[model samples]
Target: MKQSQPRYIMVGGFLGAGKTTAILKLAEHLKRQGRAVGLITNDQGTGLVDTAMARASDFPVEEISGGCFCCRFNSLVDATRKLTATTRPDVLIAEPVGSCTDLMATVTLPMKQLYGENYRIAPLSVLVDPIRAMRVLGLGGGRQFAPKVTYIYRKQLEEANLLVVNKCELLDATQTAKLVAALKQNFPKADVFAVSARTGDGLAAWFDRILTGELSATDIMDVDYITYGVGEAMLGWLNATARLSGSPVDGNELLLRIGCALRDRLAKADAEIAHLKMTLTATGDGLDIAVANLVRTDAVPELSFRLAEPFTEGELTVNLRAQAEPALLERIVREVAGECGAALGSLASFKPGQPNPTHRVDAGGVEHRPVLP
Candidate 1:
């Protein structure tokens, strides 16, 4: 039966898990099924690459800044209402902050209990970058985050109803099987899928599961608020905007240069990159844009979207998340942007504070206020 109420689906994961790409893919799938879709993107600050990416696709999208969906519950509701009022979308897909966890307790349960009449909440789906997951699980060789940061990553998986091992193309059959087995062993309650959002491998099954699946009741994991805050503080977050003017420049090359330079600097500083992405859009033509992403320090920058024509003047937005000091990240970005012919404009850099959720549900479905920092 076609549902009357709009469905609320939230896709979450740690940084660099390809959450944005997955959400967009899911939205596209939903649209093709004759269902209207809306997207809500969350971030810690303004100038989000995710928001820009979604908007460029001409989807009715809204962004909640300055916090994750758990902390900005009211804003999440507001964005949904705004989209509902305008687009009347049948399915609303939300991508929460990548570094955030505890979505079942903080987001899904609350929405189901409080706004049950308005939206049908789907099971929480958490995506993981296979390589990162292997390293975090001590099953692969790669740079890893500190214990504190890893805490956030593990907690995300702990609360998921659907565990999606994204970027399966990056691994072989043997490696993929090993990672899937590990995830199954650790999170026995959740169903796992190995998928590649870029190549469209193993996505149809996952999409079908989410589209028809309902949120099932489960035990909520105990989260240490103080440690969660400390873990978030360990990551430096930078979001910047700039204006470009001069001869026609290759936006793709510009983004690659900036991403690679930043990656090298951070690597030399002994900092591990979570995810760094930027978008260059012609100021005169919003639709004409180039987008690039660097998920790991060792990985090369990939241009996900490219502009058809080179522009002499455009607007550039850079979003960098890494395990370094915000001040240091900001300084490096400024230097790189200047060299790349972009005049930096408004910029904000800081570490995420403690997790203070607007509404938190306990194991028994009771609501309580989380202790704030």
Candidate 2:
């Protein structure tokens, strides 16, 4: 007789999709059901917003940094094994990099084909931000992506076993219905659901499905190897940590200003902000400091920090994304911190930092060595 293994559920999405929030809600739900949960976060670089958010939950969070789970498949397995060893969780939820796709072939298919004896792969649920969906599908006028970026976005949806329309609360019923209809017509085989992680709407049904669902491998997309490779190569990732000294500024206000400032700056530079997120965890006080992500400058920010208490000192983690150069991202962080310090009537200390690039794949299907700064 063999020991029962933990169920593995992976939630994936394009840039700015609400995968992190959905995972948090799902973890909470599972915990309420008396199940211990373990979380794994993947990112293209070392400093990841998702990792910080997941860790803040105080759960057993493991991070597979510098690569998506597919490119780092062995690391994914190792992380799962470590999580299993420590927590023996009933369920394990993993969130992959936002810009990544082709999970069915690279991740799910391999997992089922190789690790079926030790774990069960839940349906691969890919989340779509309504705004991004509209932009990618040409339903609304927004920043147009280069051909390669567009290719990755579409490929992400192409491999999903479940397509979830996220941030639906921002749209009216009619608008939501229109999007859902279009998604259904386009991806007829996958089950599509509308969920607002912010409001907990339609999550219960989604949860129910996850609990009883079986993930059969789907037909993965044939990606343009070269184009796919270049698109990913052009993108640079940066995550940083900063020590702040402020006079007990309102955490929410500070986060709002910082997020808006960064969004505005990135927009002026004509750089696409795939996701710019920051999390502030205070040291002494019990209050949740602040967390905000700007998927788009024009869109409303998402908050990961809910105030349960207040604190005077803390560490702040900044996760930035842009189509600009990696150096540009570092500069942007410095400028944002200066502005935030001035607003708070004090100065915040930011140390020199570099994004540790974990994965670099080209369209030719060539893998590059990880770049560390």
Strongest candidate by lDDT:
1
Query: Mind giving the per-residue lDDT tens digits that candidate 1 earns over 102-153?
Result: 8898889989888889999898999999989999998989888889999999
Q: With candidate 2 superimposed using the best TM-score fit, by how many Å does residue 218's alpha carbon deviate from the native?
A: 2.7
Assess candidate 1 and give its TM-score to the true structure.
Answer: 0.97
- lDDT values, one for every candidate: 0.89, 0.75
Candidate 1 runs further than 4 Å off: 368-373
Candidate 2: tens digits of C-alpha lDDT, residues 257-371: 7778777777787878877887777776423557888886566566767545443567777777656677777677778877655322222222112222233333233444333
Compared with the true structure, model 2 gives a TM-score of 0.87
Sliding window of 10 residues with minimal summed lDDT for model 2: 343-352
